[model samples]
Target: MTVDLERAAPAAPPAPPRRESRIWLVATAVTAVTVLLIVYPLGRTVLGVFGIGADSTVGRIGEVLTSGETWRLALNTVIAVSVGSVVALMIGAVFAWINERTDARMGFAARMLPLMPMFVPSIASAIGWVFLASPKAGVLNGWLRDVGGWFGLEMVEGPLNIYSWPGLIFAYVLFLTPYAYLTISSGLQSLDPALEEASRDAGAGALATFRRITLPSLRPALGASVLVTVTMGVAIFSIPLVIGTPADIDVLPVRIVHMMTHSYPGDIGGALGLSLLVVAAVGGCWLVQRRMLAANAHATITGRSSAEAAVTLGRWKWVARSAMLLFLLLTSVLPLAGLVLVSLQGFWSAEVRWGHLTFDNYRYLVDNELVWAGLRNSLVLAVVCASVAMAVGVLVTLVLARRRGRVASTVDAIVKVPSTLTHIVVALSFIVAFAGPPFDLAGTYLLLAMAYVVLYVPQATFYATAAYHQVGPQLSEASAVSGAGDGTTVRRILLPLMAPGLIAGWSLVFVLMTGDITASSMLAGTHTPVVGFVILDMWTAAGYPKLAALGVLMTLVSSAVVLLVMTLRDKLLVVR
Candidate 1:
C-alpha cells in the first residue's frame, strides 16, 4: 500500500512539471515574437531620434534633439490628454453605474443599439459637431440663436464654439465613452453580488454600499477605463485636427504629424522625439495601473460570480433612460442628422434650400475609381489582418491553456500591452523600422497589413483567451483522453465552442481596420490610398458636401454591420 501511494504521488508530480514546462515555453515564445514584431520597431524609432542606427537621413549631426517647439507643445498635450481622460472617465463610470447598479432600463449596447454611432469613424463625429456648433454657421447654434430672440438673448455666434478647448474635450468624451462603457460594464456584470448584499444587510444604504463596497471592487475596471481614455486621448487626431487646429491648439499628435507632413525634409527627428514623450507617458500610466491591480486584487473576477443585487431607482428609471437617450441623441442622432443635411446641400449653409440640394457627391463616389479601389482594399485588408492576428491569438491561447503559473500570468499581461500602445506610435514605428532600404515596403499593402496585425493583435488575443478560458481545460483533456490530436481537438471542440466570441472579435477588428485613420493617415500614400485618406483629402480640399456624403455612407455601413452582428448573435451564440 505504501509503495502504491508513493507511485501515485510521483505520477502527479511528473504531470505538473510537464505542464509547467509547456507554459514556460509558450510564454518565452510569445515574448520573443512580441519583442521582435512590436517592441523592436518602437525601440528602433526611439533610438533614431538621437541619431542612432537609421537608414533614412533623419537625424543629421547637429539636428538631433534640437526641436524646442516639441517641448512647448508637450505642455498643452499633457493638459488636454489629462483633462479629457478624467472627464470622459467620469461620464463613462456614471453611465456604467446607472446601467449596472441602478434600476435603469438601459444597457449601452444590449437594448440601446447605440453601437451604430460608436462605430462611426471619429473623423465623422468631429466634423459633424463642427457643423453643429461652429461659431459662424452651425446648424444647432443657428437654431439656438433663432430661438434666443424669444428670450431676448440674441447674438451671432455667442452661444457655442466647436473650435475651442471645451469643444475638443466634448468631442473626446463622445468618442471615448463607448470604450469606457464597454470595459466598465463588463467588469460590473462580473462582480460578486454577495458582497453588496452583505453591505445592505448590515444596514448600509445604496449610496453608502456603492461608495464603500462597489467602488472598491470596480477598481480594475476604473483603472482600465482611465488607461483607455489616456491612450485614446494621446493617439486621437481627428477632433484635434478638425476642431482644435482652427482654434490654434497644437496638441502633440498634431505636432508630430505636422513635423512629418508639413516640412520639406520631414522632420523625423523631431517627430519621433515627440513620440518618445507619449511612450514615457504610457509607460508611467502602465506602472501605476499594474500597482493598482496588484494592491486591489480582492475584487478580481472568478468563474462563479453571480448577478448583482441591483438598487431600485423607481421613478428615477425614466430619468436615467432619458439621460441615456440624450447621450445617444448627441452622439448618433445629432451628428448623423447634421451629416445628412450637409450632404444634401450644395455647400455648408445654415439656410437649407430644398430645391438647391444635389446628389453630386454620391454620383462622384460611385464614378470615382479611387473610392472603389480604396473600399475594396480596406475590405480585403480588414479580413486578412483580422484573420492573421486572431490566428496568432489562438496559438498563444492554446499554449496558455496547457498550464497555469507565474509564467502564464506574465504572458497574459505581455499580450495586452500592444493594445495599450498608441496607434500613432505604432504607425511611426513601422515607418522608421521597415519603410526604407532593405525592406523598401513603404507603399506596399504588405507593410500596412503587418502594422495592422501588430497594432491590433492584442485585442484578438484578449477575445481568444476569454473564449478559451470559458471552455476550460476539461474539454481539451477529455478530447485528449478520447485519442484526439491537437489539431482535431481544436477543430472539433474548441473552435465550435469559441465561435461566438471569435465572431464578435473578428467583427470588431474588421470595422476597426476599415475605418482606421491614424495609421492610414501616416503609413498609406496615394498609391495605396484607404478610405480614411480619401476622407481626409476631401477635408483638405474643403469639399464639405462630398465629405459629408462619404461620412454618411460610412455610418450606414457601420450601422448595418452592427445590426447584422446583433441578429446573428441570437442564432449563433445561443448555448443550447
Candidate 2:
C-alpha cells in the first residue's frame, strides 16, 4: 500500500491562454495617472527653474546664487537653523535620556508632552509663543509688570520684543524638539540593556558607564537626530514667517516669497532661480545623510518592542525625574498656558492688568471675518490634502513594495526632496511650474493640495512600505490560492493591516499642512486665506489680540480633531 500510493494520480499542467486586454488597459491607466501627478509637476518645475522659455528664466538661477542679498539671507537662514537645531537636539536628547534612565511615574507623560508640539501646527505654536512672550502686552510681561509695579521695579519696558531671533528659536524648538525625541527615543529603545549592566559590573562608574557604554552606543541615533533637526530646522518657514517677520528678519525662504510676490512685475525668474539654488543646497545635505545611512555597516533594528532599556538612576533618580518633568512643563504646558491667557484678553498688548482680561477675545473670534475664513480654509485644505496624500501614499507604497530595489531607493530620495527644501522653495517651484507652463495650477486649492501631497508623501510612503514589508507575501499568496483577485486581496487584506501606519502618516501630514504658512502664502487665493496666512496678516496688521484669539481657536480645533482620530484608530483600526 505504501509503495504504490503515488501512482494513482497525476497532476494537470497549468494552461496558457489568452491574456486580458483589461489588465494592460488598467496598467496603462495607472501609469498615465502616475506620470501626470508625480512626474509632470516635478519635470515642469525643473525646466522652469532652468529658464526653458523665451523669457530665459535659467540665467536667474546663476544670478540668484551670485547676489549679495541672497547670500545674507542664506547666512541668516543657516544661523537660525543651526542654533535652533542645536537647542532642539540638546533638549530632546536630555529628555529622552531621562525618560530612559529614570524610574518615575511622570516618565510616560514626559515623553508624551514632547510629542504635544508635533500635534499642533507650527503657525499655532508661533501665535501661542507671541501671546506669552510679546514685549509690550505679553501675558508674562503683564504678570511681571503688575508685580514690579507693587515693588516699584520697571518690568515692562517700551516694548518687550520676543519677536526677534530668540523668539523664532523658542518657537522652532517648541515645535521640533518632539521630532528629535521620538526618533532618538526609538534608537535608545533598540540598544541592548545588558551592555549597560555589563559596564557597571566591570567596576565602571555610572558617569563613566554612560559616557563610554551608553553615549557611544547611541551615536547612530545622535547623528540621525542632528541630521533630522538641522534639515527640518533649515527648511522650516512657518515659524520664521510668524515670529521672525515682525522683526524684519528675512530668511532665505521669506526673501524668495517677497521677491516673487511684491517685487516689480513679479520677479518670478529670480524667485525660481533662488529656489532652485536653495533646494540644491538643502537637498544636498539630506542626500549626504541618506548616503551615510545607506553606507552603514551595522544593521539597525526596528520592530514592535515588548521590552525597553531602563537604567537605574540610583542617587540621581529623583533629580533626573524632576528635571524631566520640569522640562516638559516648561516646553508644553507653559506655551499652551500663554495662549490661554491671551485668548481671554480683550487687548493682549495695550493693557497690562487682569481687569482688562475678558472672554471678549474668544467671543470676537467666533464673529471675526478673518478668523472664520482662515479656520474654514485651514480645515478644508487639511482634509483635502490629507486625503490626496493618503491616496498617493497607497499607490507609491504598492510600487515600492512590489518592486523593492532601485525603484524604492530612487523614490525614497526624490519624495523626500521637498521636506529638505524650505516650503518657500516648493511654493516658488510650483509657481514656476504651473503659473504659465503647459500645466498651470496656480491660484487654486488644487495647487495647495498637490503641494501638500508632495510635501507629505515621503512620510506616508516610508511608513506604508514598512507596514507592507512587515505583512510579507505569504498572506497575499494565501488569498490568491483562495481565488481572491489582486485588487480584492489588496483592498480586503493589505489596506486593513496598514491602518495604523496610514493613520500615523496622515496625522503627520495633517499637522504640517494645518500649520503651513510659506506655501499657503503663495497659493492661497482671495477666497481661501488659510489660518497660517491669516495669522501672518493679523500679526503684520498689529492685531496682536486678534492673532492670539485665532491661535486659541485653531489650537482647540486641532487638539479636538487629533484626539478624535486617535480614539477612532484605537477602537476601529487596531492593527497594532
Candidate 3:
C-alpha cells in the first residue's frame, strides 16, 4: 500500500504556458484598423446609396436612378473612358514595340521616358495643358491661329478648346499612357522572341508576324493595360474638375462632387447612388479582365530567354526615335515647361514674351500665408500618411506571407477594396461614417491623413508583398526556432530585407498624396488646408498664376523627395 501511494503521488509534469503568436496579434490589429478605416466607411456609403443611413433620404436614390441627367453623366463617363483608354493603348503599344523590339536611337532614354510623367501631378498637368490649350488664351492655340492667319485661313479665335470633350480625352491619354507603357513594356520584355524569329525565318514580314504572333502573344498584357487605362480614366477626378467644370460638362465624378458639395443641403444619397454606378462600371471591367486573363493561360514564354536579335528597323529607326521623343515631349516635358512658364508670367495670356514673364507669381506664393500653411500641412500629411501606410502594409504583408489561412487572404482583399473606389467616393464614405457623433473627425487634418492612408494602403501592400516574396521564408522560420518572437524577427530580419520596398512605397505614396486633389477637395476645408485644396481654390478663384506657381513648387518638392528616396533605395539594396 505504501509503494502504491508513492507511485500515485509521483510528480505531475509541469504544464507549459500558452503563448499567442505575434503574427496573429499583428494581423488582428491590422484587420481592425482596415475595417474601421476602409470597410466601415465604404459600408456607410453603400448604405447611403440605398437611402438607409443617417445622411440619406428616402426615394433620393430612386430619383437619381431614374434621372435623365444621371444617364447622360454615365454616357459621358463611358465615352471619356473609352476614347482615352483607346488612345493610351495605341500610344503605349507603339512605344513598347518600338523600344523593346527596334534599335531606336536613345533606346535607354525612351525606356525611361514613360516614368517621367509620374513626377508631374495630374492636376498640375491639367493646369499646364489648360494654359497651352484654353480657347481664350492658349499659347499653342495662339501660335496655331497665327500660322493659320499666314495661310489666309480664317481660323477660329481659339481653334483648340481644352474645355471640351476632346481636350479631356487628350489630357487623360497623356496621364494614362504611362501606366499602359509600364505594363505593356514589362510584358514585352518578358516575351519570348523565338516565335517572332521563326516566323521571320519562314518569310513572314514584320507586320505579319506582329499581327499573327506578337500581338496575340501580348493579348493578355494588352487587355490588362486597357483595363487599367479605362479604370483610371473612369476614376480620375482632377482632370475632369479642371477641364470639364469650366465647360459645364458633367461627368460622373464631377457630378458626384457637385451633388455632395453644391446641391442644396448636400444630396449625400444621390452622390452615393452615383458612386454605385461608378463602382459597378469599374467592377464589371475588373471582372471581365479577370475572366479574360484566367480563361487564356498564354504561357508562351518562361523565365529562360534564348539569344534573339533585336528587330532591324533600319531607316525607320530614326522615325521610331522621333516618335518616342515627341511622345515624351508632349506628355511630360511640355506640360512641365508650360507650368514653369505660366508660373513665371506676370499674367497668364496667350503671349509668351519677356515683358509678360516675371517672377511675381512665385514671389506671391512665397508671400501668401495660405500657401505656406498648405505646404506645411501637405508635408506633414505626406510624411505621416506614408509612414503609417508602409508600417501597416508591412505588418499585413507579414501576416499574408507567414499565416496559412483564409483569414489572411480575406484581410488582404479587404485592404485592396478601397483601391477600386474612386478617391472622391472614399472621401465621401469617410465623411458619412466619421463626420458625426462617435469618432467625429470632420474638417481635421487627421481625417485627411486617414483618407490618404486608406487610399494608398493597397499600393504599399503590393510593394511590400513583392518584397516579402523575395525574402526566403526559411530565414523567418529559423529566426522563430532561435527563440526570436515574430516581432523581433520582423524588426531584425524582415525589416532589413523589406527596406527597399518600404522606402519605395513611402516615396510613391508621399508623391501621390502631396498632389492628390480628389480626396483633398472632398475632405479638406479652411481648418485643414492642403496643397491640393489650395491649388483648387486658386484655380476656382481664377488665380491661374498662383496656381501655376504652386504647381511648380509641388513638382520641385516631389522631384527632390523622389530623387532622395531612389538614392536611399539603391543604398539599401546595396547594403542588403
- In lDDT terms, which candidate is top? 3
Tens-digit lDDT string for candidate 3 (454-527) = 99998888888878887879888999899998888888998899788778778878888898887887788887
- TM-score: which candidate is best? 3
The sequence of per-residue lDDT tens digits that candidate 1 reaches over residues 322-414 is 777888889988988888888888888766778888898888878888777776787788878988888778777776666589977777676
Clashes per model (N, Cα, C within 3 A) = 0, 4, 0
* Candidate with better TM-score, 2 vs 3: 3
**Comparing 1 and 2 on TM-score, the stronger one:** 1
Off by over 4 Å in 2: 1-38, 101-108, 148-152, 156-161, 205-220, 287-296, 300-309, 350-356, 470-472, 573-576
What's the C-alpha lDDT at position 236 in model 3? 84
lDDT of every model, 2 decimals: 0.77, 0.70, 0.81
Query: Per-residue alpha-carbon lDDT of model 2 for 196-315, expressed as tens digits?
Result: 767888899878988987776676787677667876776676777767888788787777777765655568777776666566656666666566666554644444332344555678
* TM-score computed on alpha carbons, candidate 2: 0.86
The 10-residue segment with the lowest total lDDT in model 1: 11-20
